[model samples]
Target: MEPSKSEDIYKETKTAKVDDSHEFNEAEVKRLSNYLSTRVIEIVVGVSHKRTFYIHEGLLCYASEKFKIQLRGYFKEAQTGKIPDCQEDPELFAVFADFLYHDGWLRKRKSLYYSCEWVMVSRCYAMGERLGSKVFQRECLWKLQHSITLKKFTIANDALCRILKATTELPERTTGNEDPLRALVLRYAAGQISTLRKDPAFKELLDEHPELGCQILMRVTDDESDCQPSGAPPEKRFEDKVEFL
Candidate 1:
């Protein structure tokens, strides 16, 4: 199905907060996105509904982009009694919760791994903007709730993702960013790759795929980088490589 006009928040961000001095720090918004990534979707969903906040993904990201400015606005309004709230307005909090939930979910999904992880990092920093240290405790709760086996499964999947990213040839040489890449590498190091666990065959495959975690320590930096194509040249004909079932 085609996405609804309501689902698109990227455009809204272009003019999201036109009246402000534009002094809000976007980098801070991105940096703080992760702390909220560990939250349960149910919790955020419940909060968003109860609060009547705009909780869809794109709007949430937009809210993050406008976080600092709106945050300042809220605080100022509170002091002046113009707004009776110290917490997020319904719309704002919903955006925050949606951003947090989607980002966290994306960060966890290996298949959806970011070539650059912009979504991942952005989600985290956005959460920090809303809830602060409380986000950290929620993350800890997430860790506590999951089993070690499940966690390991998650890690191994992430490792494969990282390895694929680092080894692939980007359409653009560089996006100058790392989203899922950093998290993926960490997952690999932390034993997320099941193949790395006890299967030597998978280990060998990983050993050969240089494109994994493609953004970090890219081929440009080293003489031995796997960015070089495989020794076997491309086949001139389909029959040369295709095996029939």
Candidate 2:
């Protein structure tokens, strides 16, 4: 059988070592190639001004169970070969497509701009949750955590507010278990509460999402017993408690 375009690209990527950190081993290349198919599905992102992405049906289904179900027999998407009117941000959906095809290319591209990285990852996590792709969600969360702990990337208040609102709106938020993304955000917020509280915009955000305020307060109170001396950074005191879900 002839190798598909995705397989050819993966082979080239492996040969070139496009991203050393996420180089696809031979076995991984073969595994990824297994999902290649000629059929393409058009996904329309955004509401008023839509952006479309043409994705391989097999790979799309393989990456997202939600897409698999939505594109199965008898569904409108199956009949039309299109998922129309998806509400995810077009740029964010582009990131999802990059993950489906090129793996770490998005990370390599976004690394240059540290300011927007957390917001991008957080939005990607929310999208992953919506698409029911645990692997994608895990990858995004790992990136977010890595940026926070190792790179010392601090999320801006406006970005945090956007992330918190996006995460809180997810259907999974009501599932009773503490969401890892939410926990991560709350932990970060708690650590930086002193500075965040001083921001008028953050104050308005708390009013808009009262639960966030409550959660931040609880996180701070709960960690007080384990806090280091006043000289220690708040993030250092709470950092150890973060658990990736």
Give lDDT per model, in order: 0.33, 0.64
Off by over 4 Å in 2: 1-30, 105-113, 172-176, 221-245
Candidate 2 pairs with clashing backbones: none
C-alpha RMSD for every candidate: 19.7, 13.7
What global local distance difference test value does model 2 have? 0.64
Best by lDDT: 2
Candidate 1 lDDT over residue span 2-116, tens digit each = 3323223323333433334423255333433333342211111223234333233222333444332223343342133222222333443443454344344322323332323
Candidate 2 lDDT, 1-245, residue by residue in tens: 24434234323333331112323345443354544543789998876678999998866765676676666544567778998766777888888897886556433323323546667778888878767677677667656654555434567777777777766754545668777777777777788888889988888877877777887888885543222122212111011233359
User: Which regions of candidate 1 are displaced past 4 Å?
Assistant: 1-7, 21-49, 52-63, 67-176, 180-191, 195-245
